[model samples]
Target: MSEGAKLTVQELDKRFGDGDDAVQALAGTDFSIAENEFVTLVGTSGCGKSTLLSIVAGLEEPTDGSVLVEGHEVEGPGRDRGVVFQAYTLFPWLTARQNVEFALRDEGLTKSDVRQRADQHLRMVGLERFASARPNELSGGMRQRVAIARALSYRPLILLMDEPFGALDALTRQLMQELLTGIWEQHRLTVLFVTHDVEEAIYISDRVLVMTNRPGRIKAEVPVDLSRPRSPEMLSDATFLEPKAQVLEAIREESLEALE
Candidate 1:
């Protein structure tokens, strides 16, 4: 692990079942994300991309090795890391503000403080005016923004996202990409996002880590090297195209292997 790395996964491994029925999801996967760095993981389906993120989030245990955040071993899901799933998992019964406030309730803040922080984060995601809207009332993109705001409400050291915009239409997905990148830049939040979209990975990441199929392990690491706060036009630039091709090629091989 690098010095001062925000999150470190050293010699990580995970396996399920045993004997002939055994399945290995991760094999010695390792990487590190620095403070406030935005890194993404791209791979073919079933490459254990989600499994790795879940381990880091402390949602699941690693069969071996360790995941550390801020130089300490992560024991379980603590307040130090926030997670946003592809599903906009807001409580339908709770309004947007209430959902965000729920995340802050464990912060030991006064009720007023929780409400205040929730509103602040909602504004950060451009949803302050819709604070009262229920999840059903909001669009898919808006609900995802709520999820982001809720994840951020408690000021976690890092954010873990699993294809948060995968469910949106093309135009909505594009808009959310811009919205998420701008918010990440503004907040300087360290992010480890998992996606299958190669262009999306290149557009919003400082580095893109690709994994091997099944028994997943890090296979390729492509640094974006693109300037921060990227725009839609960057998609057409040669700089963007090269790294995108590199990532696509990496996954293409793994995808074929998976098919075989």
Candidate 2:
């Protein structure tokens, strides 16, 4: 592992079933995430992105190899890593603030402490005004923000997001991306986000990790050298378009070959 790497995965492999029924989701996958850095993983569907995240989150154990966080082996899910999924995952019955408060329940905090902390996170995600609203009453984006607040409330060492904005419409997705980048900059949380959207990957990540089709493994790591605090306008700039084109070409070639 490198000196500043906050997380490391080595020789990781995952398989399901047996013999002819067997399927390999990840084959000797390896990668490292530096502390306070935002890294996004991009690939076609079923490329083991979510599976790899599950391993890192300790939601599932790898059939081979290891996952380490802050140089320590990830034995199981801990408060050190928080996850935001594509689904809102907020309790439908619970209000937005209540949902965030629920995450902090296991931290042995006092009731007052939980409320204070939850309120802070909700405000950070710009959902403070909707604190009393239930998930069903919120828009798709608002619900997602609630989910993000719930994750951030735990004050985890890293935030692992699996296409949290994938379910939103185009305009909503754009807004959410900007919101996320702003939050990331403000909090400096180490993030490992999984997305199939190449444009989204390029727009928000410090570095983009491209993976092979199935039995996925890291194919390439492309750093986005554009200036920070990237806006939607940057997408039309030559510097940004060049890297985006390169990544798109790589994905296009891979997809075409997969069809062959």
Candidate 1's TM-score reads: 0.98
TM-score of every prediction relative to native: 0.98, 0.97
Candidate 1, 33-67: lDDT as tens digits: 99989999989888999999999999999999999
Question: Residue 26 of model 1: what lDDT?
Answer: 96
Residues 152-181, model 2: lDDT tens digits: 898899999999999999999999999999
Query: Which runs in model 2 stand beyond 4 Å of their true positions?
Result: none
Cα-lDDT of candidate 1: 0.93
lDDT of each: 0.93, 0.91
Error of 2 at 125 (Å): 0.9
* Model 1, residue pairs in steric clash: none
